[model samples]
Structure formats: C-alpha cells, structure tokens
Target: MIDSKQKGMIFNVQKFSVHDGAGIRTLVFLKGCPLRCRWCSNPESQLFKPERAYNPNRCLTAEVCGRCAKACNEGGVTLIDGLICFDRSKCTDCGSCVNACPTGSQTVYGYEMTVGEIIKKVEEDDVFYSRSGGGLTLSGGEALAQPEFSLALLREAKRHRLATAIETCGVYPTEVLAEACKYLDELIFDIKHLDDEKHKKFTGGSNEQILKNIQYVFENFPSLPVTVRTPVIPGFNDTEEEIMAIRRFVPLRDNVQYEVLTYHRLGSPKYGYLGRPYLLGDVKADDDFMRQIRAKLREYQG
Candidate 1:
C-alpha cells in the first residue's frame, strides 16, 4: 500500500475559478473516474495515468529536422507533411516529446502529487480566498474515487481555516462520502438525470447510489451547504421533464440550492488533443433555454 504522503493524482490546479463554486476558488482536479459521461468537459481527468495531448493549432515547424520523433522512445511520433503525426497507441506518456517540441505542440495531462505538495500550492492563494470568501475546491473525474487523499486534503484545508467544497458525482460508497463531508464546508453534487436508466446510459453508472448518498447527506447533515448542478446536455438530458425531475429530488433543506448548467462546446477541442472522437458536436443550449429551465425550477421552490 502506498503511504499517506503518496496519495492522489492531480491533473490540474486551476486557480481563481469563479464559476465552479462560491467566490474566487482554486479547483484541485483529481485524477481517475468511474463514469464515462459522453459530454464530460474535462476528458483529461478521466484517466489515472498521464496521457499525451497534441494541439495541432499550436504546432510550429520551419526547415528544421524531426527532433521530437528522435526524443520519443516508442517511435510513436512521425513527421507527415512537415507536421507532427502522433500515434496514440505506441506512446508511453514519458513527456519526452512534449519537452523536445520547441513550439509546445505536445503536452501531457495528469501528474502524481502528494497532499503536502498540493497544500503548498493552494496556500499561495490564501490572500485571494480570504478576500473573496473562497478556498480550495476538490473536483475531478470523481473526488470520492480517491477517498483517503481527498479526506486528508480537506482536513488540511480546514486546518488552515480555508473554506472547502467538493464537486462530486455521488457514486462512491456511503462511508467514504460521509468521511469526506466531515471536513468540507460545501458539497456540489451533480444530478445528471432523474430516470435511473437514462442516468446509467449516459454516465456509465446507475443513479441508485448517487441518489442514496445525496438523500443521506441532506437528511443527516442539514447544515452542510449543498448545491445540485445538472449539466443540461442536448440529446441526453435537456428536456423540461428531466430538469424538473432533478429539481424534485432536491431535499427540502434550507441550505441547499439547485442549478442548471447549460451545455457548451468548450471541451470539443480537448477531444482532438486527446485523440478521441467528439461525441457532442456543435450542440449547445442557448441562454433563453437555460433561463426557461431556471424559471421552471423556481416552481419547485419550497
């Protein structure tokens, strides 16, 4: 077993994130995820291991030779028409090619970092958190998937008197959820769909455990501020009935709020970079639709 110091893998430490949680927050994106949501914005966070990404638009080549190809040990890179052609299957994610690429075309996602390392980085923005009522937010493929690491990070964040929040899919065991919640000041639980079958079909998991965990948190920990966010996808779950059904599931707690996150194509470029096919293409819900959905949700207000 790995020691407590060698806990979780983090993909990105996004600072001054305003839309994820309350105030200007630092979102510590943890690696590894159980669900394979078709419309995931951060596909890079899905895998546990470091994966290579290529931004074709960022590539720059002149009369130079193939330096990147020589840097890679797997022979995964080849120059095609003076442009780099990366073979995803043969790549080993050593980040040698990324380092060799002078123009910064090649990049890798995900990095293994200890809890102490993360805390040190997060502590850099203590002034921002203090001024804006913001702090660290643990988000990921699924933060609860790495329970021990998340719990330790939360505990340390609390030790520093920072407000903590977690963006979870609520698919983990009840015990793990409870322990993580002990240190978090807020919980941002995601409710993708109301119907169990649709939830499983889209998110690669059933809503049974997700629902149970949310209900448990609401019923038991009334003081824990909970915000339920649903990413309103186009074909999957953008209907009025689906949104209202999610609103109905919100517990009758005083400290809870429901949010409808309209879908956007911001992550489509990521699929190309990751060498994955884009599932949701050119599909987006407009502001009018989001406002309409938000208005409908108000009908369910207690």
Candidate 2:
C-alpha cells in the first residue's frame, strides 16, 4: 500500500527523460545527499530542507517591485543603492518571497510530496510507459538518502505494476540497499573512483562503503541488471588509468555493464541562482577526449 501521508522532500519531477534509464522515463529527483560532489549539477537538491533560488534576469528591480522585500519577515531582502541584495544569513526560506515575486525570479528549491501524490503524477504518463517501456526512475541528490520515502515510492510503484529503477551512489547502509534491490527493476550504480583517498578528496566520502555495497549487490544479485557509470571529470578522474581502475574493479558480466559520461558545465547557471559557485570552472571534455577515454576503456575491458 502506498503511504498517502508519508511525505518526502522533492526538488524536481522531470518527464519524458530518456537518459537515466531504459526507454523514456520520468525522473524523480529527491532532496538530500550524503556525498558532496564538487561538480554536482543539481545544487538545490543537496540540502534536506527548502531553499531559495534567485534568477537575476527574471527579477524586476527593487524600484520596480518591492513585493519580495515586503513579504520577507526576516529582513533578508533589502535594497542597496537602488539594487536588490539578498541576505542569506537572515533568510529562513519561508517561501514568502517566492510567492510574492511577480516574474518567478525568487523560487524555492524543495517541497514535500507523498508517495501517493508522486505516483499519481507518474501515472499520467501511463500510455507512454506502456508503449515505450518506460516507467518511474528515482534519482537524487541520493535516492537512498531518504530511505523510507524512497522505499515507499518503489514499493508503491511496483504494486501498481510499473517498472521501477533507481540511480544511486550506493552511499547508504548495505542492509537498506539489499531491501531496496528487492523492489527494483533496474539499477544504475556509480563507481566514481577506486582509490578511497581520491574519492574522499573529490566527493567528500570514503569509497569503502560504496565499494562494499557494489560488491554486495554484484555477489548477491547476479540476476539483477546493473549499469556501472562513471562521470569523467577533468583534473579528477579523466585519465585512462582512472577509468581502468574502475573497469578492473567491476568487470562486466552477463548482467553487468559499464558506461562513461563526459563532464559538462551545463548546470553552471544554476550555481548563480542558488548563490553557490560552480567549482569546476571552464572545464571542458570535448568529443575527441571522450572518444579516447571510451576507446581505452574498451581495450582495458577486453
């Protein structure tokens, strides 16, 4: 039974997505994450609570619309020399400024939604799923970070006879992951780096747990189809040696596969909105570089 009252923080619900999993899918981006990847695209999904985002281009000047200032009870929004400034320290993310904004300049990132509510939304694309072999795919900030809510969504989705999948970093407890795998149809796992120290330096977490969980899944769930993915980041894990390390760790089998994702700065604009800096500034992974990495990986896999 889907928990109608069990609400979890959600940041986005992208429909008609063909990237994360099989066929066309609806990607449900949950809030909160355990690891702090420097190149994270969805900066808004990192926190467990609702946070505000600002769009300068969409914002009307303070002289034109002072509604946000009026709505902010904490004095977080103020005017400075005819320009608007946001005092993040004083802000509580009450979402009043978001509501008051006329042009959608001020917005909140996370919101609460029950499993039932989410399932209802996903069901809207029922015909599409049936035709294209698509269904619900849970993504994050780390889907398993909110274990209960994520499990509820998975169970509820399966109860409805929908194909369920999850893209996880495998940072959660091994027991929890084991339980979750029972309800999953497909799994996209991330193995960023084999070296624990480098993993910690880049993602702010040890690779011990992640590697342990990956082994647990592979050894225990041999029949389960798993796709191991690595996002090739410049100045981090971009070299052939790094890719070879990952390939050696999780060698492909009948149900296991490997894929590499090229790094991009497409989400740079989001950092400006969230009042955060995109750490990987101007890092480019051109087509030629990615092709070389893939070619090397194939040679190593053989």
Candidate 3:
C-alpha cells in the first residue's frame, strides 16, 4: 500500500500554468536535481537539502530586529554594519532563522509535504482543469530523482482523474523513468545537447544515456505524446548546426514534438540568494534567432 504520509521535498506549486501541457496545469516544483547546468534558472532547486535564503531588501535590519542571529545554532547568522550577513558554511540548514524572522527577510527553500497535502493543493484548480482540460505537472530539479515519491504522487493524481504530465532532464535510470511514464499523460523531456562532450561540459553529465533513453522511452511507449524541449543557451548550443541537429533528431513526424525554449535571466537572482555567482551573466536567446530556429524546425511538417 502507498503510504499516506510519504513525503517529498518541493519548493513551489505554481497554478494555472498554460505552458507545461495541453491546457492550464498545476506545476509542482520538486527540489533536488542531479544535473548542474550552468544556465539553469532555478538554481535553488539543485541542492537536495532544504536551505536558508535571506533577502536584504526584506530584512528589518539588525538594529530593529536581532531575532535571526539569536536563533542561529552554528552562529551562522550575524550582523555586519547594521546589515544581516548569513554565513552559509557555518549553517546547518536547520531553518532556525527562517522561523524566527519577523519581516519575511529570512526564508528557506524546499520543504517536505505528503502526497495528501500536495493533492489537496492540486485539487484547488480542478474547476479550472475541468473547464479548460487542465491538470497537474511534476517538474523539478528532475522529478524522477525522487522516484518513489514521484510515483506515489502521480498515482494519486491519476486517482483524482486529473491529466498528468512530467518535465524531466532525461538523465535518470531508464527503469525509474519508465515506471513514472506509466502515470504520465505527456512527457516533456529536455535534450540539452546532442554531443556527449559538450553535454558533459555544460550539464556535468554525458548525453550518451540521455540520447539512448529518448529512443528507449519513445519505443517503449510509442503511443505516449512526447515533447522534446531544448533551452537555447548563448555560446553553448546556439549555432544553427547544433539546433538543427536537435530539431532533426527529435522526430516531430509522429506523436513526438520539438520546442526551442528561449533563455532568460529570471533565475539569476536565486543564485544570489544562495550566495553563489551567476554563471551565465548577461546571456539571452535572441528573439530573432529563436524565431528562425522555430521556422526551420516547422518546415519538417511540410
């Protein structure tokens, strides 16, 4: 029996998202990822452990409120020139400051929630789902990283009679992915690069298995609708040759489809929150470049 209290770590549950699937969907952002793509927008989701994040703008300042420093177990929280300085190295991620803060300046990312808790949140948009063919999506630092929790969650989503989808990095073991696929209605897999060497340089993992898994998944579930998405990063996979290789390799002739995701700076701030430097500084996927790529890929249908 699936444990009613089986828990998973998640950072956010975005509702009414139209981009993830066939209709509006509730996107559950799971925490922890295996890949370290430098251009990754959600840098906060990469770590498996729940972490503390402080926003100086939201802080009430140490002069007015010295509560966070008092709550620190490792003395990780300190005041410097009336400003709060969080020493992450000394910290253990116990969430003491996060709980003690008054102005919401101190915060923690990722928390454990059971399948029942998550389903309750997903059910909130059921009215919208029924009216617009919307449902739920499991996304993450790689949803399959938490295999058992994800399977249980997706199983419950199916029980609720909701359309389900998964956004994966395609790096997990094939059996783990294959089992999750049984519960997913649509698979949105990302192919970062076609070349294994460049793939390792960018994402810290070779695309050898990612490429093989793509074929394995398609062959195993031929009827399942698949969308292969590629995030076009500048100075990485931006060339016409690279993009074209991806477009051609991902078969759109059948149930499979291809998408060229334009890069953005949205996740850069999250890097600062974690006291890490943004790797892809000032990088963006130009609209014209993406437009041409989209047009070229669409020629396949004709």
TM-score of each: 0.94, 0.94, 0.94
Candidate 2 residues 1-302, lDDT tens each? 44656789999999999987888899999999999898888888899988788887888898889788889889888887987778888998778888899998888888899999999999999999999898999998999999999999998899888888999998989998999999998999999999899999999999899999989999999888899999998888988888888888885797888999988887789899888888888888867878988888778667
Runs with alpha carbons beyond 4 Å of true place in candidate 2: 300-302
As for model 1, its CA RMSD to the true structure in angstroms is: 2.0
Question: Model 3 over residues 191-272: C-alpha lDDT tens digits?
Answer: 9888888888988888877888889887889899999999999988998899989877877657888888998988888788
Which window of 10 residues has the lowest lDDT sum in candidate 2? Answer: 1-10
Cα lDDT, all candidates: 0.85, 0.89, 0.87
In candidate 3 the C-alpha lDDT for residue 255 amounts to 84
Clashes of 1: 0
Clashing pairs in 3: none
lDDT string, candidate 1, 156-251, tens digits: 778778899999999889999988889988999998987889888878889898999998998778899999999999888877887887888786
- Rank the candidate models, highest lDDT first: 2, 3, 1
Candidate 2 shows a clash count of 0
Answer with 1 or 2, whichever has the higher TM-score: 2
| Cα error, candidate 3, residue 20 (Å) | 1.0
